[model samples]
Target chain A: MKGLLLKDFLMIKGNVRSVLLFLVVFCLIALEGNDFLLFVPALISFMMFMTTFSYDEYNKWDPYAITLAVKRKEIVFAKYLGSFILLFFSLIITFLVALGIGIYNQNFDLQKTFTLLLGCGASILFLQDIVYPLFIKFGVEKGRIGLFVGIFLLSFLLGWILKNVSISIPQDIYSFVVSYLPWILAVFLLILTIGSYEISKKIYTKKEF
Target chain B: MKKILEVKKLKKSYGDFVLGPVDGSFPGGVIVGLIGENGAGKTTFIKSLLKILQAEGEIQFFSNKKEDIGVVLDNSFFPEILTAEDIHKIMKNIYKNWDSSLFFSYLEKFSLPKNKAIKNLSKGMRKKLEIVTALSHHPKFLILDEPTSGLDPVVRKEVLDLFLDFIQDEDHTILLSTHITSDLEHIADYILFLDKGKVVLEETRDVIMDTYGILKCGKDEFSKISKEDVWRYSESRYGYEILVKDRDKIKKKYPNMIVDKITLEDLMVFVVKGRIL
Candidate 1:
């Protein structure tokens, strides 16, 4: 597991210069915006995760990795671990940028801005959960359709949540729920992430290369 | 000799193309070559043995753990974006027995630059890098899938010598799949011939080279020999060229006939052209 992580880290390390450039550009833009700050880093990190698979597919490394003494399950786990680590790192960068903006703008809405950022982060993660398994089941070339489908579904879901999800509650209850919504959603995403891992593991185990 | 690896009733299928029911074992201390024509299931058989593709059968490795066997695949396993030093880091965590010093030594011997990414390396260099990676792991068994395909004659000879060096350890064994029958002729102790997804013949290299003979004779002389004695044969305007086993026995039976020794390439052509003789 450590080895797989290190392999991915090194692979991603090659893109660090571009990634830093990405951060600088997005960070500057983020400082001038609100919840939009979270969007750039999260998307870049997710795209970075996706690019690693293209590398894997181009080189046909999975077949070679399977030839190693490691267990089939560990190979699957490594990708999941690497992607999650990326998401987590970018999540921090995104959050810090969001906070820096909130601090800059004296009229900051902690509850609204934080919740919006959390929603964006959750959507990106959920997309990763689906995109990764699709990539694993069908290689990058074939999985491209699935990726498009995933992106469409993600956008549809985000749009649905923004417009259709409305609760008719008293002011006091609404305030209570809205204040704790990020925590509740965090736990929910954690469950989905585990379920996603299990699903990916099952598919990966029976896979040939 | 100890049997280091074994396969029993192994098989895989993709609609019409089926590979296997292959069963053979590599003895503990020798280089074994796997020979076959294109689409002869050579790659599939090795992939199945490694469990790269799911197949039905029992494949037992040297240490029971499949990891003890190192592989030099036809394609580079690490991303072409990675350098030798980068792969060294990746492999350090992948294999328990990966030896950095041995790996670097081979890299130097092969003249592979450590910092250069794989994409920049020539095909011959990539093959060399794969071999270097496979050898440095100190595996008890090495599974090579066309490990010397792009190499020059000089480099191929040097690599073949390296395989010889590996088998000197007594515990080391190799399963080499190659098109270069000449290389096998030089280094392989055993040859397993595959044709249309079947193990047509498995014999010691010496037995195939010394005992297996081609008896060039006329139709009348060929008819006298039993069909069971002939592995394969073809008729030409000149005469009938027959591949036969038990060279001494045939010599005794027909002292007037000539029974010339055969090479691995001739054996493969006979097996595939005649295809089940």
Candidate 2:
């Protein structure tokens, strides 16, 4: 598993120039005080993590890796672990960058920035949790299509709910929900990621080549 | 002889092709060359043995752990973006006994650049790199699929010599699948021939070279040969060519008939293309 993770990191390192260029561009855009700072870094990290699968497919590395002494489950687990590590580093970098920009602008809302960053990080994790299993079972190309359609449907459902229904919550209930939202989202993310790992492992274990 | 590998009732099916019911026990310290026509299941059999593909079978490797096996697949390897140096680093962690110095020595021997990405290397260079990686781990068994497919004759000879050196230890074994039958003729101890997913022939190289013969005769003379002795026969404009076992027996039985020594290529063509008796 360490070998596999190291390979993924090396693969990313091979394209470091392009990755750095993209980061620089995103950082400049993020300095405009837009909410892009919250999500762009997470999205960039996710994209970088997903490209490892593309590299694997291009050279048919999975079949070759299977011939090695590594277990099938370890291969799946490595991808998940690599993604978490990338996400962690991306979160820290984004926090620092947001802080620099916030302090420079003299309107630093530490609480709001933290909340939005957590929400964005959780959203990206949710996306990964759903997509990893799809990629494992159906491969990267088909999985990308599935991801787009899923995003479309989710947004459509959210739009319909907002447009058609208005709910009035008691002040106490609303306050309780708002205060516990981060904890709720964290727990949900944990369950979803674990379930995704289990599904991906099952798919990979039974996979031929 | 001590058996190094054994398989029984092994089978795999995908799409329209099915490979299977294969049974064989290969002896240790010998290089077993697997030969077949396209889609003859040589690659499939190798994959099944390595568990790269799911197949139904009983496979037993004597005195060898999974980690002790090295593999060089034909079309699969490291990602194209990775350099040879990166592979060395990755494999050092993957294999408990990976010898980094030996790997670098092999890279130097093959003239493979450490910093160049795999995509930049020539096809033959890539193959040499794969072989180098397989050898550095000190595996007890090596399973190679077309390990010398793209090399020039000179590199091919050097690679073949390397295989010869690897099996100097009587405990080591190699099962190589290749289209280059000439390489097998030079180094293979046993030939395992496959035709349409079945083991048509598996014999020691000495037995194959000494016992198998091609009998060239006219139709009238061919008619005199017993059907049991004719493994396969093909008719051309001038005469009929028959593949026969026990060349010396047939030669003694018919002193006037011409029976020439058979090569692996001749044997494969006869088995795959000639009419069965």
Candidate 3:
């Protein structure tokens, strides 16, 4: 696992300058005011994460990786863990940004902002659980289409709730759901991530080169 | 002699192509060359042995501890964007016995630039880096697929010398799959010849060189030699060039007949592709 992580770090290191540049440019534009900018770093990190898969496919690196002292299980775990690390950093930066926005507005509400950021981060990480397993089962080229479909569904679902469902709910009901929905979904996705890991292990173990 | 590696009925099939259901072994302290034609399952067999591909077989290697066995694959492994320095860091974490000083020495010796991205390096430089990385940790058994394929004669000779030097230790063994039979002629102690999916022949190199011969004689002289002694033959303007499996027997039977020396290239070409004339 250590070796795989080291290799991935080296893999990621080469792309760091570009990814960080994306973050820097998008971050400045975001500062003017757009909650969407918060996702730019996480999204770029996610794409960077997928590039590692392409690298493995490029020259048959995974089979060679296995010949080292590592196991297939460790390689699967590293992908999940590396993405988690990326998301975790994205959130930390998001948290600092949220705090700055709250301070500047002077209507600081820590609980409300944290819940929104947590929910957004959790949802992206959740999609990764499904998409990563798909990536493992198929190469990144096939998985790319599946990822976009999932993203469209998420957007449609969010649009529907905002346009139809949320408006119909009573004031108290809206507050209650908003206060607790992120926690509930976070727990659900955590269980699903475990399932993803198991499924990925089965696929990766059966894969020949 | 104690066996360093052994395979029993190893087999792999992909659609129309099949590899193995063949068997062979590498006893300790020798270099074994695996020679075959283009479609002859050389890469598949090597990949199967490394467990890189799923295959059916009983294979016991390096006492079943895979880390003690090093491998040089035909394709690239490390990401192309990373430099050799990055690989050094990655390998330090991968192998327990990875010797940085040794690896660095090879980098300097091979003239491989330390910081250049692998994508930018020429093919020969990339190959040297791969071989250097595979050999950095002192492995008991080494397996290489087409190790000398694209190299120029000079560097190929140097790399072959390095491989020959690697086996100076009595326990070190190498299983090299290559089409360049000439490379093996100088260093290989044994030759494992594969045709189609099966091992057509596996014998000590010295023994094969000493016993195998190409007999060149016209119709009258060729008729005198018994048919059973021939492995394969081709009709030539001068005569029939027959590859004799047991030159000593023919030499003894026809005292006046010249038993010529056989090159590994001639030996493989005859057995695998030649038709009996």
The DockQ leader among the candidates is: 2
lDDT digits (tens) for residues A58-95 of candidate 1: 99888888888787789888888888788778878777
| DockQ score of each predicted structure, in the order shown | 0.68, 0.82, 0.68
Q: For candidate 1, write residues B1-277 as lDDT tens digits.
A: 8889988999999888888888888889999899999999889988998888999988887687655788987664898888999989888887888899999999999899999999999999989999888888788899999999999998998899999999998789999999999899989998998898988889899988888888889978877877788888877899888888878888888898999888888888887786234
Q: Tens-digit lDDT track for model 2 on A44-143?
A: 8899999999999879999899988799999999999999999988888788878878888888888978987897789889989999999988899999
Per-residue lDDT for B57-142 in model 2, tens only? 89999854667898999899999999999999899888999999999999999999999999999999999999999999999899
Model 2's DockQ score:
0.82
Clashing pairs in 3: none
Provide the overall lDDT of each model, using Cα atoms, as 2-decimal numbers.
0.85, 0.92, 0.84
List runs of model 3 lying over 4 Å from the truth. A104-108, A149-179, B255-257
Chain B: TM-scores of all predictions: 0.94, 0.97, 0.95
- In the range A34-152, model 3's lDDT, one tens digit per residue, is 77677666676777777888887896888788777778888899888888887888778777776776677666678766776776677678778889988888888888788788889
iRMS per model in Å: 1.4, 0.9, 1.4
What are the chain A TM-scores of the candidates, in order? 0.80, 0.91, 0.82
